[model samples]
Target: MKAMIKVTLKNGVLDPQGKAIMGSLQSLGFNGYDNVRQGKYFELDIEAFSKEEAKARATDMCEQLLANTVIENYEIEIV
Candidate 1:
């Protein structure tokens, strides 16, 4: 089984890296972009009997290490 995970900061959190990227974009003459945010993506292959199991395992992984539950949110897609 394969799991695709996306981890992003929750609203109201400060993103200094995102701000720096936006500033660099503007300096490079890239216009019309209002804001930019950064996130994490992960692709994992694991042993699972079903799609549901894959998702469950992915969710567990996120809760344990992939994401910081207090400030980051995660989504899982199983294939």
Candidate 2:
């Protein structure tokens, strides 16, 4: 089974890296770059009988390590 996880900051959290990237883009003459935000993606291969099972395990992984539950939210996709 293959599981992909995307972790992103929740709304109202400060994102310095995203801000820096946006500034850099503007400096490079990329006009009107509306906004930018940063996040993380993970791809994992595991042994599981069903897609739901894989998603459940990946959710656990997100809660435990892949994401910060308080400030970040995660979504899992089974592929």
Candidate 3:
């Protein structure tokens, strides 16, 4: 099975990197972009038998090592 995980900063979190990107874009003549946020995507190949198991394991991975739970939120999708 394949598992895809997306991790991103939670609402109200300060994202300096995102802000910097926005500034750079504006400097390059990109306009009207009010906001920008960055996130991470991870794809994993696992030996789970079913989508449910893959989802569970991926969720555990996210909680254990993939994301900083204190400041980030994650979502898991199994394929």
Output the number of the lDDT-best candidate.
1
Go through the candidates in order and give each one's C-alpha lDDT. Answer: 0.93, 0.91, 0.92
Worst 10 residues of 1 by lDDT: 30-39
* Error of model 2, residue 13, in angstroms: 0.3
List the candidates ranked by lDDT, beginning with the highest: 1, 3, 2
Show where candidate 3 strays beyond 4 Å.
none
Error of 2 at 43 (Å): 0.8
lDDT of 1 at 33: 84
List TM-score per model, in order: 0.94, 0.93, 0.93
Q: What is the C-alpha RMSD of each candidate to the true structure, in Å?
A: 0.9, 1.0, 0.9
lDDT by residue for model 3 (1-79), tens: 8888999999999999999999999999999778698999999898988889889889899999999999999999888
The clash numbers for all candidates, in the given order, read 0, 0, 0
Q: Give the TM-score of candidate 2.
A: 0.93
Model 3 CA lDDT for position 39: 94
